[model samples]
Target: MTVKDIATLLDAKIICCEDSLGRELHAACGADMMSDVLAFVKDQSVLLTGLCNPQVIRTAEMMDMVCIVFVRGKLPDENMIELAIERNIPLLSTKHRMFTACGLLYSNGLHGGATN
Candidate 1:
């Protein structure tokens, strides 16, 4: 699905890079730990995370993630937002908790691409 589809599915607010809403993503990873994300992320995927910090943006950029969804109604600070915008990554925020948000996207066909 596209980033816009994920935004609609999670009832998330598009925080930046609205133009990237059309980008297609085949998978998702939900994590609060950047280390796990770095170890498991797949190609052009979405990251559903609860950690609201600049490191999250940096990790997503390094992983080449399609976008980031901040769960549990958490929003990043201005610095993180600026970093995301500079990286040309779309950021979304949702009121759903991490598990629920990840489940919603998974149920809609976005799978976790990491393999054991």
Candidate 2:
């Protein structure tokens, strides 16, 4: 589904990339550990995390992620948002818990980036 659709469904705030709201998101990655995100995520444009840090943005940039969703109402600080803006990654925040958030997206057609 599209970024806008997902944002609407999750009741997330789109902190950036209004233009990219139409971008199609094929998959999602959920992790709070930045290192694990770096190690595991691939070709996954959407990241579901509770960590609100600059390193999160950096990891997304390195992984070519298009958007980041802060789960459980976590919020990114200005520096993290700046990094995301610089990297052109849209940032989103949702009130849903991590597991429920991921599950909602998965049930709605989003898949894990893992290959069979």
Name the best candidate (by lDDT). 1
The lDDT values for all models are: 0.90, 0.87
Highest TM-score: give the candidate number: 1
Query: Over the stretch 1-116, how does candidate 1's per-residue lDDT look in tens digits?
Result: 99999999999999999989999999888889999888766574888889998999999999888899999999989999899989999999999998889888889888877553
Off by over 4 Å in 2: none
Q: Native-vs-model 1 lDDT?
A: 0.90
TM-score of every model versus the real structure: 0.95, 0.94
TM-score, candidate 2, is 0.94
The superposed Cα distance between candidate 1 and the true structure at residue 49, in angstroms, equals 0.5
Candidate 2: deviation at residue 67, Å?
Answer: 0.5
Model 2 scores worst on lDDT over the 10 consecutive residues at 107-116
Residue pairs in clash, model 2: none
